[model samples]
Target: MAFIQIIEGRTSRFDEMQALTEEFRERSEGASTVRRGIETRDRDDPNRFMVLVFFDSYESAMENSNRPETDEFSQKMMELVDGPPTFHNLDVLKDETS
Candidate 1:
């Protein structure tokens, strides 16, 4: 089943955060299990943001999580955030597109 991980946090350093994300993408190219990633900032509160990462399966997500690059990115990302981020691990039960 498809899996999605939701990461929410508040960061005043979005530009740097984005750069790190791009860098990670480059470094993990071809080896990453990430199917897609969507980054969003809250409309009412610009500092609040959420990242939705999609993967083919829960195991794939875990594999990606265990990578050294992922660990490095996460540590650096934490430094840019206001506080520890919240995470939501979801198992996709339905998906459709028009």
Candidate 2:
């Protein structure tokens, strides 16, 4: 099943975060298990942000999480945020395209 991880947080350092994300993408390259990702900002709150990351399976996500570079990236992300980020892990039950 496809796995999605939703991460939500408030950050005043979005530009820095964006740069870090780009760096992570370059570093991970083919090693990353992420199939897709969507970055969004809350309409009502400029500082609030959310990221939805997709993986082929829960195991793939777990594998990415276990990577040392992933850990480093996560720690850096925490530093840029106002507080601890909220995470939601979901297993896709249905997916359809027209």
Candidate 3:
């Protein structure tokens, strides 16, 4: 099944968080497990941010989560937020084309 991870974080450190996310994007370019990701900011609350990450499968996501690079990325993410980020794992049910 296709998996989606919805991550939410505080917006106080948007710039720093964006930089960290960009770094991860650059490092994960050639990674086969990570399919794609999008970063979004809350329209009402500027201090709120969310990241939608898609992986080929749950197993692939787990594998990518365990990589050393991911650990480093996690560390960087922690530094830019007030509290721990939230992650919601979901199984995609439908697509617009379908």
| Cα TM-score per model | 0.97, 0.97, 0.91
Among all windows of 10 consecutive residues in model 1, the one with the lowest summed lDDT is 12-21
The segments of candidate 1 whose C-alpha lies over 4 angstroms from its true place after superposition are none
Cα deviation of 3 in candidate 3 (Å)? 0.5
**lDDT accuracy of residue 12 in candidate 1:** 95
Error of 2 at 80 (Å): 0.2
Name the lDDT of candidate 2. Answer: 0.96
In model 1, which residue pairs have backbone atoms overlapping below 3 Å?
Answer: none
What is the per-residue lDDT of model 3 for residues 1-98, given as tens digits with 9 covering 90 to 100? 88888898885879888888888878878874878888899899999989998987889889999988898999888988989988899988875673
Error of 2 at 6 (Å): 0.3
TM-score of 3: 0.91
Q: Tens digits of per-residue lDDT for model 2 on 1-85?
A: 9999999999999899989999999999999999998998899998999999999999999999999999999999999999999
Candidate 1 per-residue lDDT over residues 1-98, each given as its tens digit: 99999999999998999999999999999999999999999999989999999999999999999999999999999999999999999999999999
The whole-model lDDT of each prediction reads 0.97, 0.96, 0.85
Candidate 1 lDDT for residue 84: 97
For candidate 2, the per-residue lDDT at 53 reads 100
